[model samples]
Target: MHFSSETRRDDGVVERDFTIGEIPGVLWTPEAAPTPVPLVLLGHPGGLRTMRPRLAARARSATRDGLAAATIELPGSGERPRGAKVDAVRAELRQALQTGEPVTPEIVDRLVLPLVEQAVPEWQTCLDALLELPEIGGPVGLSGGVISIGVRLAVVEPRIAAAVLFAGSFVPRVVLEEARRVTVPVHVLLQWDDEGNDRQVALDLFDALGSPEKSLYANLGGHTGVPAFAGEEAARFLARHLR
Candidate 1:
């Protein structure tokens, strides 16, 4: 929660870059917000630096809606060095894509499970620090993903009131089982023709969610072909639960 720099945006949102121990993160707060406003925890798709614009835009959207937003660099992303596990996973994924072979379940497990294990605790810790801030309050929401991490957080983090999950990633069986434990409200987005994802897996994972209140919005396109309106729809979903 130690901030190194702060910038004020034209939209009346203040962005701060910070570090909690070795983890780097950013927080965005709307100017003149009331004490203890709702908070949204964002998850990124790739390297945090590359995802900065998208994440910052999401923060601004949350801020404009009178909520605070925060996100952390996931393990082996951003400034963190890639450990052997992540390196192996990336190599395996690349090879599978290059060879036009469907990644085996065992390979998917190896690729995602360790990252899920490491990321969930880190997100919980980030949530702990975020809630401690005087300007943030209860009923947190989680948005974005590497899907498995979002599923795990929704299952274990009681503070998270809702989640907006992006369904463009694989789901290991163990993670699918854990998804059955999630009880928070969820809004899931699926790019129906995502080149790298298993469409059936995404559908099955959605089916596995234990949440009584969950909606799926599936569109016909590749991973990056999500329509603008879909994002707006997801934002509205978060607003409904968080605001």
Candidate 2:
């Protein structure tokens, strides 16, 4: 188990990478003045396009107000290459065994829904590494399309304290039906005029959430900017809950 850390930024965004467990993640902290900060873990969208600068910038901007954010590439994307991704993920299981920590997957069938099933295990693995980081001693929040639908399903565990979802369409009905069981506070951010399935999907889940603290926001933008919205809102939300 080796760990690597680095920082990068153009303009006001600051990006850093932490390699823990078998997965190496690019953690983004805003370049603003240092402050004791909350940790926000961002789940990138599935497919090649999700691993891009725009999403990184979104996560970085959230830290501007005083928060620590990081994004880990799932098995086959970002800096985590496909060949070694699975072995890296399995390494997490071995590490968990050594630490006596529990690691579980929310979604199991990614072929049908690349968002939840394919990436949920990766999310769980990333969370495990994050909890061990010196700078990340706070509640965790998650947001992503299809890939992050597992966040709500992950409610059986208490480690995750908060979450914000943006245009997720993985298990619309199941997630909505089970939304109330999630004890953690959640927020759904979306585009009011979305012309795709995500709009309706997020809306339905938002309606089903039993948590009084949960709410939904339909932004002016469309799908592409959802991560940006989640990043910004997550900062505020984390400050209130984790800080």
Provide TM-scores for the models: 0.97, 0.69
Query: Model 2: runs farther than 4 Å from truth?
Result: 1-5, 8-14, 18-22, 30-36, 47-50, 76-115, 147-150, 225-234
Best by lDDT: 1
Q: Pick the candidate with the highest TM-score.
A: 1
Model 2 scores a TM of 0.69
Stretches of candidate 1 exceeding 4 Å from the true structure:
none
- How many pairs of residues collide in each model? 0, 3
The sequence of per-residue lDDT tens digits that candidate 2 reaches over residues 1-243 is 244645565556556655656566677665554543566766555432446576565565556646677666665555555645455554664675578664333222222234345456666676676667565656666654442354543464467677776655545344556677776777667777664444665676677666778767676766654545455665577567766
Give per-residue lDDT, candidate 1, residue 69.
91
Report how far residue 92 has shifted in candidate 2, in Å. Answer: 32
lDDT of each: 0.88, 0.59
Candidate 1 per-residue C-alpha lDDT over 1-243 given as tens digits, one digit per residue, 9 for 90 to 100:
799999998889989999988999999999888678899999986588999998988888788788899999999987887888779887988998899988888888988888989999999988899899888887899998699999988888888899999995577779889988999999999999998888888898899899999999999999878798998888889989998
